[model samples]
Target: MKKINLIIATTLFSITFSIGAFAQTETKIGALIGYGTEIENIGIGANAEFPIMEKLTISPSFIYYLPKDESGIKINWFEVNANANYYFLDEENIDVYGIAGLNYSSIKVKYENSFGLGGDFSSSDGRIGLNLGAGANFNIGSSITPFAELKYVIIDGGQLVVAAGVKFNL
Candidate 1:
């Protein structure tokens, strides 16, 4: 948990400086924090975005789980994702977006019993998906805009995944 927090902090620091230096360009960069539900687990993820077009962007993200209980013991997982966002409504500084892309996930399961099965399991595969979400910019007095969004990732076998987050634009 300590290490995860440290990595997130470091990533945010780098993003801050990089955004400051790249503010003059059209490149949009920011950090995202949000929760997701997959396979009965709650996840927290962070994302970094880079624009490829006025209506398109690429975002790479990672997620982790706080220790959870199943019946009596504890378990956890880590996930990673990369996807593209297409702005369906691009106007002013706000954009309502839809996304379609692939994701790679690594899930780790731990058990109370030291002799339990599935030792340090990791699964990585291409998941094809889509997301429908909206984001609006907060027009404060600063160049860094505040935004909020909600999205759902539709997985195979009709499993529904949801995410919501607040972000600072740069």
Candidate 2:
């Protein structure tokens, strides 16, 4: 509970900071499909980009991994990330950026006996993590932009994540 609160507070602070620093700027919101190395599964999520400066942006995204079941055990996982992206190469067609961020990961597990013996159990855990990576955005002279990112989260066992999707500017 305390950890969750901390994550919320930190996210709010980053958003506030970005708005305070740049009140008038274009924002982008979009959906993405992601792959996580630790879970070896694909996830789908939403993301938003808030430009804080000409070459810097604050991005927040969430990813939920598809639940997997094996041998009567089920697992569910998700992550929330707030990252700062520094664009090294900003162009009309493509924008490349470096990433650094905070990550919060949670996973749950449930087990059930197939024989219907009434013996079942469940468990869950959450952890705070850090991320570092790089990504690029492609603009085709429209309101919609496609982007791809590869980031590694350093936390509880560590994981590599890759995402790609389109964002709409607004």
Candidate 3:
């Protein structure tokens, strides 16, 4: 729908802006395992470090979460995020950075909730939200690097999250 299109457009704009303003390094792709209150998920992301300036990078990641409920029912959701990373400490092969950007998320309810008269209600929607986080990366001996990140969404009640992943330099 319109909202989905808007999310795609905005993401493209940001990636284009970053590429224009920063010289890009080689491309690297990785996967992640994330844990959050009320949810557990897995993610895959790509990293693009800026050329000439190694202190900055851009990361685009996608995630899918399993359903959970008090009554042992499942509720699924998915999200995609693009973050701008600024490294405060850039060592030989290690870097710790701060992140900020946009996240587009969609929630789907697979099971219906029973009403007072045993009726069921279910719904699904997509939301474009803000993302902010920080992470540290350590060079694992060679071209491989391991990283840990923590991010939170700017939702009304807030969504706290943590992730661990590895990146391979291309």
Candidate 4:
């Protein structure tokens, strides 16, 4: 009889904790601006974050860099990424998280040769890279959350990315 009573108590506690965790989950959408070495210019991006567990979130984002003119060549770059973030500090108004992800990046180049042959050329190859980062979210008032992050991308020659953005919870 005592064993059965203890089992019931444990099950109830587990169910209660699970429900409380789910109630704290949130979904947010945001826009970001990033600057990186490989990108060669500033990029604008957008992302959506979905909480999957008590302390874990998955975010997907797309970024497009402004075309840069280096010498006579025009370089265009962009990236699409899916990231998983783990929150070490989850608070009512502040959260700090670590990030890891995979990114697909592409670059295109256009230039005119000395022979007066003008044409557009692009890389037939795209790269899949690894991203590691950390970020913080400051929840203010009722709906707005401002964030800042730094990411290191391991790709061709590597890149260091810095980003800041604001998100609205929905």
TM-score of each: 0.61, 0.87, 0.74, 0.79
Superior by TM-score: candidate 2 or candidate 4: 2
Best by lDDT: 2
Candidate 3 lDDT over residue span 51-118, tens digit each = 33566667777776755564735576767787778889878777789989887777766655554556
- Candidate 4, TM-score vs. the true structure? 0.79
For residues 1-170, write the lDDT of model 1, one tens digit per residue: 45545545655665566567557654444444455556565666666666666777766566665657676455665555556777777566566666565544434454444567655433233344555454544445455655556556665542345554545555
Regions of model 1 farther than 4 Å from truth:
1-24, 39-42, 114-141, 156-159
lDDT of all predictions, in order shown? 0.56, 0.89, 0.70, 0.78
As a TM-score, model 3 comes out at 0.74
RMSD, one per candidate, in order: 6.1, 2.6, 4.0, 13.5
Clashing residue pairs in candidate 3, if any? 67-75
lDDT tens digits, residue span 8-120, model 4: 46534543454455455677878999998776689998876778878898777778898888877778777777788899997888899999998777777777565667654
Off by over 4 Å in 2: 1-23, 116-118
lDDT of 2 by residue, 56-102 (tens): 88898889999999788899998989899999998889999999999
Error of 1 at 67 (Å): 2.4
Model 1 whole-model lDDT (C-alpha atoms): 0.56
Best by TM-score: 2
Residue 169 of model 1: what lDDT?
A: 57
Residue 32 lDDT in candidate 3? 75
